[model samples]
Target: MTPDSLSRRQLLTLTGSAAAAAALASLSLTGCSDRYKLRCQHQRTGEVYRELNIEIGSVITHSWIHSIELSRWTDIYRFDGETLMLTSTEFEAYGAGMPLDEGDVSVQDGQVVIENIDREFEAIRWIHSHRVDYRIGVDGDESLIDTDALPDLEPLELRPK
Candidate 1:
């Protein structure tokens, strides 16, 4: 065959290769569009720290010490597949910045707790500090993130990916 033309077998092989490539491209572009994940990153510098595959109705909790009260406090979050919701907060003791005299109040696990806040947040940000002892918990597994290693200027954030 001439250089500009192909034999019958060569033409068929080339056509098959092109068709296979097209199918792979389409599958890659359309596959896993509904997959959900939780992305954690630095708010100021936009440095990603971690990405955890999550599902609907997942729970994420942040436990830290109150700067003023010097007592431990925990903020609970729930994933609705599209966004994160601040469901409630637990306090070892009622202190500054807490609703002591009003709103829903309850007790759980021998600690003073509140429930049913029902607030929706697009993302959560916190400036990590060595003193406050920031801890993030996904489901029942803790120690997924380390706050002390991150710098102060880069505040940590949690949002949907």
Candidate 2:
């Protein structure tokens, strides 16, 4: 073949390879973005939880107060792969004019067991609380749970300073 024709063919081949590489890189990035949008939901209560931007072996605490004198709740979560373990603590400052408090509000060290994980990133969690058995449903999605809309509960540290 002529030298000019050979050069033209080589250029076309290189250009095609570069385009493929770019498309692959974009797909890889898009996959990561999708993972970041994962969420967890409680089937019974319809309570949805936004996955905190936490790394493995890391713990994050989210607290809210509902008239500190009346009630308050704190949730601590640890994430590992498709599994997320959560420790939820709720406190009632006053009960029927009597001091009645329950549940461990302190940070506990350990891993919570995951019951199930589905193709849609929906996870079923089994929690033993106050001697009662409970199942929590967790699902992933693009939209995150809006804590701002919750009534009577104000996030302790998420507010602007």
Judge candidate 2 against the unseen true structure and give its global Cα lDDT, from 0 to 1: 0.36
Model 2, residue 54: what's the lDDT? 32
**lDDT per model vs. reference:** 0.74, 0.36
Per-residue lDDT of 4-115 in model 2, one digit per residue for the tens?
A: 2233346447557676466546655765334332333444464544443433434333444443343343444444444534544334443344322433333233322222
lDDT of 1 by residue, 27-117 (tens): 4486433367777888867778888777678899988888787777888889996788888888877756677654478888756778777
Clashing pairs in 2: 39-139, 39-140, 41-138
| Number of the predicted model whose TM-score against the real structure is largest | 1
Model 1 lDDT at residue 43: 84
**The candidate that achieves the highest lDDT relative to the unseen native structure:** 1
Which regions of candidate 1 fall more than 4 Å away from where they truly are?
1-34, 100-103
